[model samples]
Each structure stands twice: as C-alpha cells, then as structure tokens.
Target: MSVTGERLKALREARGWTQEEVARRLNVSRAAVGHWERGKNEPSYDTLIRLARLYNTSTAYLIGETDDPSPLSAAQGRKRPRSVPPAGWGRLTDRQKEYVRRVTDEMREIMVKELLDGEQ
Candidate 1:
C-alpha cells in the first residue's frame, strides 16, 4: 500500500486533467483533490470508488497496490496469456521469440541512452 503523494499526482497528471477538473468529476472541491495529491488528506470510501471509476483504474492501483491497473482483473471469461504471437510472429519458435526480445531490449537500451545523451 504505497499511498505516496507522487503516485497520486502521477495518475492525475497522466490524464491531463486539472485538480478542479478531477474535483468536478468526483463531485468534490478542488481543494479536496489538491489535498489528496499533496498527501494532506485521503478520500473517503465512496470517493475512492468514484476516483477509481473516473480514472479507469482499480482502487488498489490508486493506493499503489499494483502497478498494473488494467481492467482485465475484474473481467469475466478472460483469456489465458498466449505464448504464441497473434499472426506475424506466430510462425516463430520459442527460441526465435527469445532472440527477438533480446535484440529489442538491446536496441531499446541503445536508443534510450542516445536520447538521454541528446544525440541523434
């Protein structure tokens, strides 16, 4: 239960909404929303539910229980995780997927470093 102020602020910022906007949606005052993001106060149970719905997230995520707030958790008749890719990569073997993942990871690291260094 990582109820950090920064996490709340991050979630709010990800939606590109102002504190007043969130407040209006949650039917609360802007000051109340500000307080929640500032770690000065916590929302009530009903308010928490409202916030979760408004943010399209789980209450656990809002309180920082898990990083994945995908609505799939509550979804019924959900499909199992598929090891085989959908179409293009479906023909590849497991070893091939591993190779692809390794190469992609390496490329991602290189690109991230280059961007951080301000290089083209």
Candidate 2:
C-alpha cells in the first residue's frame, strides 16, 4: 500500500473502527474507505480534514508531511483569537442576552475549534 494508505489503515485499525463505521462517520461508501486504504484513491481536501478530525490527528501526518500525529494547532499552543458578538445581539434583554450569548459562544467555540484544528 501507499504510505498514505498504510497510515490510513493503521489509524483506523488503531481506533478499532470498522471500514463501515468510518464510512458512516464520513458519510461515504464503504467502498470509498476501501479505496483509500488500498491507495486506489486519495481523499479530497475536505474529506481529509474530516478524517483527521475523526482520528484526532493532523492532516500533515495523514498525508505524510510530519510523523507527529498530534493536532496541528494545539501542538503549537496557538491562542484562539477573540470573537466579536453577533450583529443585533445588543437588542436582547439583559437576561436574554446572557442566555443567548452563552449558547452562541458554545456553538462558536465548536466551529472555531473545528476550523482551527483542521488545516484548510
């Protein structure tokens, strides 16, 4: 198998996930996962990002750039940039604002973590 394929197989096996399980998580066909593991095909950029996220590793490691499988940004200890409140957020009542902001912040953190954790 190709280096990328070998790593992909190894990572999936390490996770104790079946090919069908990986495919289900990725919203792809089991055959597609097989193709990736066999090196008959390579995942797209976006798919690679998803795989790296699911595997808790870096695309750099998946694609054979670096051997270190730790996350790219977390390993570097980069600080998250401050996020601005959403537009029209001040129109809410004080209590409403607090509740909404908390939920918004939580959702934003998930999005930011996903974007930051995966290389574009």
Candidate 3:
C-alpha cells in the first residue's frame, strides 16, 4: 500500500476512529476517507492540511516526508510574516477572538521553548 495510505490508516486507527468519524471531522463522505486510506485517491493540498490539523500531526508526516508528527517549528511553520488582527480575525466573535489569542500565545511559547531546547 502507499505510504500516505498507511499513515492515514495508522493514525486513524491509533485514535480509534472509524472512517465515518474521520469523514465527519473532515466534512467529507466516508467513501472519501476509505478512498484515501485505500490509496484509490489522494486528498488535495488543502484537504491534506486540514487532515493534518484534525489528526494533530504535521503535513510532512501525513505526506510521508517525516516520521515526526510534531508540527514544524515557528520559523518553518510561518509561511509569511504574522500580522496583528490577521485577515478574518475581525470576523470572529469576541469569545472566538480571545480563544485565537490564547492559542497563538501558547504556540509562541512552545516555539520559544523549542528554540531554547535546540540551543542546549
């Protein structure tokens, strides 16, 4: 079987989720999930990224580029300079905005820690 298919199946099975459950999270049909796992088809780049997020893994891992599931460090992860109130941030409700802020802050902290750890 394809590496991508293997990883997808392994990750989903490891989470004890059925194809239907994964489909629900991906907003796709169960057949889509089955097709992906069976290597009958591949997800688009956008869907691959979404899958990585849903599985709490790195796109690299999903695509068989790496064994590590941890997301890229901030430097590698950031595709562009971060802007305050990033596009669409204003569209979120106040509570959602706060949640985004908290998550962003936590991610920053984790990035810093990773950087420090690498230096040691």
Say which candidate scores most in TM-score: 2
Candidate 3 lDDT score at position 27:
94
lDDT of 2 by residue, 72-99 (tens): 6644753333475444546655854554
> In candidate 3, how many Å is residue 110 off?
19
List TM-scores for all candidates, in order.
0.56, 0.63, 0.61
How many collisions per candidate?
0, 0, 0
- The residue-by-residue lDDT of candidate 1 on 20-43, one tens digit each, is 888888788999888888878767
TM-score computed on alpha carbons, candidate 3 = 0.61
Error of 1 at 77 (Å): 9.5
Worst 10 residues of 1 by lDDT: 71-80
Ranking by lDDT: 3, 2, 1
State how far residue 89 of model 3 sits from its true place (Å).
39
Ranking by TM-score: 2, 3, 1
Provide the lowest-lDDT 10-residue window in model 3: 79-88
Residues 1-120, candidate 3, lDDT per residue (tens digit)? 556688999999999999999999989999999999997887766687788788888765775545677776566665334554455556656854564455455546756897889899
For candidate 3, the clash count comes to 0
